[model samples]
Target chain A: QQQVKQSPQSLIVQKGGISIINCAYENTAFDYFPWYQQFPGKGPALLIAIRPDVSEKKEGRFTISFNKSAKQFSLHIMDSQPGDSATYFCAASMSAGHNFNKFYFGSGTKLNVKP
Target chain B: DAGVTQSPTHLIKTRGQQVTLRCSPKSGHDTVSWYQQALGQGPQFIFQYYEEEERQRGNFPDRFSGHQFPNYSSELNVNALLLGDSALYLCASTPDEGFGGYTFGSGTRLTVV
Candidate 1:
């Protein structure tokens, strides 16, 4: 079973425009939600992360809006740039106990920003 | 500080052969985890090691096994490789206690024929 589900397998946006990707999860045990950006031939880099306690967290142009009640979260990238054209992945993990930090990742959303 | 480092960035093996991959965690990190990523797919967790012990594992088959050394380096071993085993194997590391994100290596591209 896919623990975390992401939508819009691919996305395209003009430079300086806003790009958004959404994700949903079913496991209530998940407490840490993180977003990663991966370039071809490289590893996924940690972009930003949020906890269930906060409804939203923003870092630079990247923002994560999380809704614990709905079991959903979304990533918003402001001022999308061509350099941002890559794959974005949302992951959920338990932050405590034995299963702590074992990430369950979404399939991923490929983003393209046309300059 | 160096990030996670994986060895033999690429490999090719025949079906029914065995393979081993190595990883060195970032400085000051004591935990290591392995993940398999198929083309165009998200990474699937294989297992995690802490304090030189296997602490948790995903739903992978027994053929996928791992070992963690006292120095916090880890190795993943696969017995009797299959074509389906062809994928990018990634190694990630984290501190023993923290909610911090993992640092990942570039990964090893494994191709099975």
Candidate 2:
């Protein structure tokens, strides 16, 4: 079973527009949700992360809106720029175990911001 | 501080051959994690290493083995490589016992022919 599911494998948005990518997960034990951004020829980097307690978190132009009960989360890039064009991934993790790691990830959303 | 670093930006290997990829953790980091990303796909967790031991592993098979050095650096070794083994191998570094986000390496692009 795909624990995490993301919509719109690819997306296109105008520069300065709002680029929204949504994801849903099946595991309620997951309390931490993080979003990652990847540019061409680079590894994915953690853009921002949020715990389930908060409804939303904003860091610069990137925002993560999480709905724990709904088991869904979304990333919104406000004032999207061509530089923001990259692949985005949503991941879930339970703060358990001595290992201290998370599990499950969305297929990833490729965002293209046209200038 | 210097970020995570990986070796061999690209590599080509024949099927049935073995290959090894290396990673150096970021300054001050004590944990290392490895992921596999196929073209046009999200990265898949292979395993994580801490305290020179394998702390956790993903759905990857035994063919995918790893070792962590005392310096927090790590190595990923794949045996009897198959076509499916070709992918971008990434290494992530983070503080051993913190909630900090991981810093990623540039990744080694592996092509199993």
Candidate 3:
């Protein structure tokens, strides 16, 4: 089964604090994992992504840590800001056959960063 | 480059009705994927279109169908809508696997009465 599970259905943090969301998957065929940010009245956008070959990746304030053995990964926001308050989703895919087509997504976690 | 675009930001329909939602992919993108996000839940994959063909599909029933045009634009048609079908529909576009992460459209919010 293609399934991605995310934790911390909701998160609240103070500005400058670290905000983290975790996800686990059952399918080992998945090679690409991406994190998306979504605000109200908008669609989710790709914030950052990671491949299984790497242990971690960082882009500006966003980072993704991956564990190939455990089939687990997570997103970390350094120095969280109020503007970061939104819903985040973790998704995985078997990029090989898809031409990167078929992808699976996690339920999502709503983050509320306070000033 | 212009990002993916969708139509009819919001719509309302009653049970047994049919609805159509449209999407235009980002500039230079050739593939489009559709997703359904219910309240407080993650977006579920409905289907994906590439090269003007239905390349893949999710677990959704046949009532949930779609079409893709040569221009890389796409449409999602839901026949005999039900209350459970009410959700935010999103469209995503990408060039190929090498291009990576998708660019998603703002989405069409549908409510069923």
Candidate 4:
């Protein structure tokens, strides 16, 4: 079973435009939701993360809006730039003891920002 | 400080052969985890190691084995490689305190013919 589901397998946006990607999860045990940005031939880099306690968290132009009751979360990138073109993955994990932070990741959303 | 480092960024093996991949965790990190990522897909957790022992594992076959050293580095071993085993293997590391996001390596691409 896919623990975390992401939508819009691919996305294209104009530079300076807002880009959004959505994700949903079924596991209520998940407490930490994080987003990763991966460039080709490179490792996935941590972009932004949020906890269930907070409905929203923003870092620079990246924002994560999380809804615990709905079991859904979304990433919003303001002023998308061509350099932001990469694959984005949403992951959910429980941070409790001995969990080893095993992450359940979404398939990923390929984002392209045309300049 | 160096991030997670994986060795021999690429490899190719024949079916029925065995392969081993290595990873060095980030400085000050004591936990390591392994993941397999198929082309155009998200990474799937393989297992995790802490204190040089396997702590948690995902739903992978017994052919996928791993070891963590006292220095906190780790190795993943696969026996009798199959075509389906061709994928990018990633190593992630974090402190044992929890909630610290993982730092991933560039990954080693394995191709099995």
Candidate 2 lDDT, A1-115, residue by residue in tens: 7889998899999999999999999978887888999999998889999998899999999899988888999999999999999999988877776436745678999999999
Cα lDDT computed for each candidate against the true fold: 0.96, 0.90, 0.92, 0.95
DockQ, cand. 1: 0.90
Clashing pairs in 4: none
Would candidate 1 be rated incorrect, acceptable, medium or high by CAPRI criteria? high
Candidate 1 vs candidate 4: the lDDT winner is: 1
TM-score of each model, paired residue for residue: 0.99, 0.97, 0.97, 0.98
Residues B1-113 of candidate 2: C-alpha lDDT, one tens digit per residue: 77999998999999999999999999999889999999988888899998999989988999999999998899999999999999999999878676756789999999999
Q: TM-score (0 to 1) for chain A, all models?
A: 0.98, 0.95, 0.95, 0.97
Model 3 lDDT, residue B73, Cα: 98
**Predicted complex 2: CAPRI docking category:** medium
**Candidate that would win on lDDT:** 1
Q: Write the per-residue lDDT of candidate 1 for residues A1-115, one digit (tens) a residue.
A: 8999998899999999999999999999999999999999998999999999999999999999999999999999999999999999999999888899899999999999999
- Candidate 3: tens digits of C-alpha lDDT, residues A4-100: 9999999999999999999999988888899999999999999999989899999999999999999999999999999999999999987776535
- Residues B1-113 of candidate 4 have per-residue lDDT tens digits of 99999987999999999999999999999999999999999999999999988999999999999999989999999999999999999999999874668999999999999
Runs in model 2 deviating more than 4 A are none
Cand. 1 Cα-lDDT: 0.96
